[model samples]
Target: MGRAPCCDKANVKKGPWSPEEDTKLKSYIEQHGTGGNWIALPQKIGIIHIHITHYYSSNPIYLSPPIISFSKQINFSISFFVFGLRMFISESGLKRCGKSCRLRWLNYLRPNIRHGGFSEEEDNIICSLYVSIGSRWSVIAAQLPGRTDNDIKNYWNTRLKKKLLGKHRKELQARNKGNGGILKQENSSSLLLQQNSAQQLHPCWPQIPVLPLSSPYTNQSPSFNDQDSIRKLLIKLGGRFSDDYQPILDGLNLQFPHGSNSLSSTQQIQEEQVHVGSSALGCMNSIGHNQVQFGQSNEYCAELVQGQGSFITTAIGEMVSSNDYSRRLLGGSLEFFYGEEMITDNKIMGACASSSCGQSTNWGETSSSLMYPSLVASNYEGVRQEMPRECAFQELSYPGAQ
Candidate 1:
C-alpha cells in the first residue's frame, strides 16, 4: 500500500530484530543499567527513535526503556495481597459469589494445596455419619479436619456411596435373620405352652356321656334314692348337676349339653346345682366323708362351697390375668413393631430434615406413637408364615377386647 510497506534498507530498522540489532540493544541495555525510558533514551543515545506500546496492549511497534525495566522487575506481592483481601471479604459477606472467590484463590494464590486421596479414619467417619445423617456433606466435612466440603461430596459420590450401599445390604440381611430367630423362639414357646395346657386337663373329662333323668343309681338304697331325688329336684330348679364326678368340674369344661337351649339362660342356676351335686357327692365318697366331720353342721360343705366358688372365681381370674399378661407382652411387642417403623421413619425424616432445614414443613409434628397395631400386624403376617398360635389366639379372641 505505501511502497509495499518499504523493503528493509541496510540502514533501515527491520520488521524483526537482526542479530546485530539484538547485540546492539543488549550492549546498550547492559551499559545503561537497564532502567532508562525507551522512547526518550533512544533519542538521547543517538539511536533511531522508537516508540513503545502501552503495557496493556498486545501488539508493539517499538520498545520503551521504562516499560521494559518495569516489566522485568514487576512486584506482584502488592497485587496478590490486595486480591486475597478482596476475595476473603467477598467470601465472608457472600457478596462476590463463591465461584469467583474460589477461582481467584485457587488459581492465583492457593499455596501448598493437597490434591490427593483422603485417609482411612476420614473414610470411616464419613461412612458411618453418612449412614445416620445422609447428605449434609458440608457439615460432615467440618467434622473431618483438613477436608473440604467439595472433596467429601465428590468422594461420597464416587466411592463412599457404593461402599455404604453394600454395607446397608448386609445389615438388612442380618436384621432379617434376627427377625427369623425371634419368630422361631416365639413359635416354640407357644407350642410348649399349648401342649402343657392340653396335658393339664383330665383325659376323660372331655368325653363325658350325657345321661337320662329317669336312670337310677347302681346303689338303690334309701339314702341313694333320697340323694337322687334331691339331685333331680335341684336339676328341675335350674341347676347344673354332673352325674359323673370323676374329674374336677372346672367351669371351663362345663359346656351345657349339646342343643340344651333350655339351660343356656339358666347357667348361674346350673352352676349352683353343679356346686351342690359336687358337695353332696363329696360327702358320700370316702374322701368326701373324711373331708366333712360328723355333726359338724356341714361347715366343711360350706367351706367346700366357698372353695368351689373361689376355685371358679380363681380359674376365671387366672384366665383374665393370663389374658392381660399376654396383652401387655403383645403391647410391648407392638411397641417394638412401632419402634421399627419409627426407625424407618426416622431415616426418612433425617434425610428430609437435612434437605429441608430452612423450610417450614413441621416435620417435628409427626409421632411414632400413632402407629397402630393393625398396620404392624399386617406387615408381620406377610413375613411370618404362621403367627405364634397363642399370639394369634390372643389377637383374634380379643379383637377390640383389649
Candidate 2:
C-alpha cells in the first residue's frame, strides 16, 4: 500500500482568524518574547505560540509586519513582528539571493498589503491592466492602493483569467461577424468579375474553343512553351535577371554537377532564383506590364491567351528558379488541397467555409484568426509542402493504403 498522504488534505482551516486565538498569541508573545529562535519559541510559550506561528506563517501580512501596520487593528503575535525584522536584515538585496529577497519582501517587508476582500475599483483596474499586460500581477498590484502582488496574482489566476477569457470569446465572435462582412464583399467582387467576363465573351460561348485557365492541363501546355519565351523576355526586360541570367547560366555550365571552391552551382542556383522570382512578381504587379499586355495586342483572344501564358510561365519559372517561391507555393497548395480534402471528407464545408471565409480589417482581429481553422489549414499545407517530397508522400499514403 502507498504511504499515507502527508498532512491532512481535506478540512484545512480557511478564512479569518478567531478573536480568542489572536488574544492568546498576542498576550503570550508580549509577555515572554520570541527568545532568539522560531523552533524554540513555540515550546517556550506553549501551544498558543505554535498556533500563532502557524497562522502568521501562512498569512503573508504576519510575515511582513510593515504591511500589517497599515491595518487599523494590531491583531498578531509580537514574535511575528520581531521575526519580520530578522527576515528583512538577512534577505535584503545587500547580501541575499533573488529568491530570498522576493520571499522576504512578499512575506515580511512590503507595505499596505490588503488581506480582506477586493474592492470594485481594484477589480476594474486589474481587469483593464490585465488586457494589455497579461499575468504581470506584481505590476498590476503596484498600480492599486493597499493591494499586494500576491493577492492580485491569486485573484487573477482563480477569478480574472476566466472572466477575461469569456470576454475575449465574445469579442472574437463580434470581430468574426465583422470579418464575415469583408469576405462577403470580396466574394461579391469575384462574382461581379465573372459576370463581366461572361458579358465580354461571344454569346455562343459553349461552341467557342475556350478552356478555363484554372484547368491544369490547359495551363501546363502553354506554360511549357512560354518557359522558353520567358528567358528571351527576361533578356529584353533589362532587369536583375537580364543582367545576372547569362553570368548565372555560364556559372551553371562551368559548375555542372559541382564547382570549385571559388564558385558553387548550389549558390548560383539560389542567387538566380531570388532574382527571377523578385523580378516576376514586381513586373506582373506593375502598371507597365498590364498596359503592354492589353494595349499591344489587337485581338482579345490573342491577348487573353498570351497574358495567361505569360503568367503561367512566370509562376512556374519562378517556382523552379527560387527555393523560397517553390517552398511557399508548395506549402500553400498542399494546405489548400489537404484542407479541401478534409472538409470534403468530413462534410462540414458549409459551416467550416462560413467560418473560414471571414477577412479581418484590423490587426487585432487578424491576429486572432491565427487560431482559426482556415489559417490552420493554410499553415499545415504550407509547412507540409516545405518538407521533403518523400516525407509529404509518406504522410499522404500511410496505414490506410494497400
Candidate 3:
C-alpha cells in the first residue's frame, strides 16, 4: 500500500496562494515566532488549512501588487516581495508540506538570500565546479557566497548548459570547416570516403603546418618571438588571446570534454589532424605550400598575436596580395569582391585571386550553414582530445577541459 500524504489532504488549501493569505502569514510571523513547529503555526494565525477542490493551470491566484504594498508598509522587505508571497502563501494554511515550508524559509525567506545576475567569475567558478564534479549543485553552491543550491541548479539547467552547448557548436563548426565539411549527413562510411577522395583532387589552399612547441632551428636570443606558439595559443583558445580579447574572440574557447567518449583514442586524433590540415588548405586557391607564407611581416604577426588593430584583414590581405598573382591580375579591391565586413577595415585592397572567387568562396553558405547536433556528440569528442594537446606546453585551464 502507498504511504499517506505528509499533511492532511482533506483540510489544507493547495495550489497558488492569494495575496490576502500571504499578508496574514507575514504579519503573524513578524509579531510571533513560528513557535518551533511549522505544522502548528498556520492555525495560530486565522488562516485555515482548507483543502483546494478546484485547480486551474492558468489561474491568477498569485496576486502580488496588493500584498507587495502591505509587505512594504510592515517593513517585511527582508523576505523580498516574491519570497514573502510564496513562503507565507504555503505556510499560511495554503496546502504545502512542512518540509516545503522549511525549504522556502531557508532558501528564499532567509535574510542573506542572494538572487539574480551571476557575475563572470561566478560563471567560471560554476563551470569549473560542474566540470570537476558533474551536477552536485549543493557542493558547487558552497563555494559561492550568498548563492543557494536551488539557484545554482536552476541557472545550470536554464543557462549554463546552453552556453556550453553553443561553445561546442562553434568548435564543431570550426572543425567541420577544418574537415572540409566531410562530417555532413552521410549514412555510410563508403560515401564519406568517396567524398573525401573527390575533395582531394581540387587543391584550394596551401597547408597550415601544425608545429611542435620547441624546434632546433631556434636562434636562442634573450627576447625571441614565438609566432607558432602565439598561433597555437589563439587557435586552441577558440580565437581568444586573453580576457581582454573576448569581444573579438567571439564564440571561441578551449572547452572540450575529457575522458573516454568521442575523442579518447590516438587514431581519432590523427584522423582529425589530417582532416583539419587538408580542409584548412582547401579554403584558399591552389597555392604551393612553400610559396604561400602567412604573416611574413613580423610586425603584422605580432599585432595579430597581441589581438591589436585589424589584424585579421591586414594579415590575410597581406598574404593574398603578396602571394596570389591572379588576385593582382583581376584589377579590383578585395573588398569589392567580398564585402566590407569580411575585409575588416578596407585598408588593405587586393584583387580577387580566382576568377571563380565569388562562386568558390560562397560566403553566405560557409557562414550560415551551422552544423549542430553532430558537433555535440561523439563526433566532437576529438576536438576536446586535440585542444588540450594544442597548447599542451602552456598551463591553460578553462571549463570542460580534460
Backbone clash tally (model 2): 5
Model 3 lDDT per residue over 1-402, tens place: 998776776767665545555545545555565779787665555432222222322233433222322212221221213423322232233345555555665566555779979976677566544432235567567667799989999997777655644553355457667775345432243323332342354222112222111211123111113334433443443331222222212212221122211121322332321111111121111111211222121121212221323222222323222222212222133333345553432211111111111112221111100111121223223423442332222221111112
- Which candidate tops lDDT? 3
Q: Looking at candidate 2, what is the lDDT of residue 204?
A: 23
Task: Write down the TM-score for model 1.
Answer: 0.23
Least well predicted 10-residue stretch by lDDT in candidate 3:
274-283
Model 3: per-residue Cα lDDT at residue 81: 33
Q: Clashes in each model (backbone N, CA, C under 3 Å)?
A: 5, 5, 6
Candidate 1 lDDT over 13-73, as tens digits, reads 4243343334324434444633434332322222222333344443333433323232121
Give the Cα-based TM-score of candidate 2 against the true structure: 0.25
- Candidate order, TM-score descending: 3, 2, 1
Q: Candidate 1, clashing residue pairs? A: 38-64, 38-65, 239-270, 240-270, 240-274
User: Which residues of candidate 3, in runs, are more than 4 Å off?
Assistant: 20-36, 45-96, 179-402
Best by TM-score: 3
lDDT of 2 by residue, 199-297 (tens): 366322211111111211111211212333544554544454344333222222221111111112332321211111111222221111111110000
Pick by lDDT: 1 or 2, better one: 2
In order of appearance, the predictions have TM-scores of 0.23, 0.25, 0.34
- Which stretches of candidate 2 lie above 4 Å from their native place? 1-20, 24-120, 127-139, 183-402
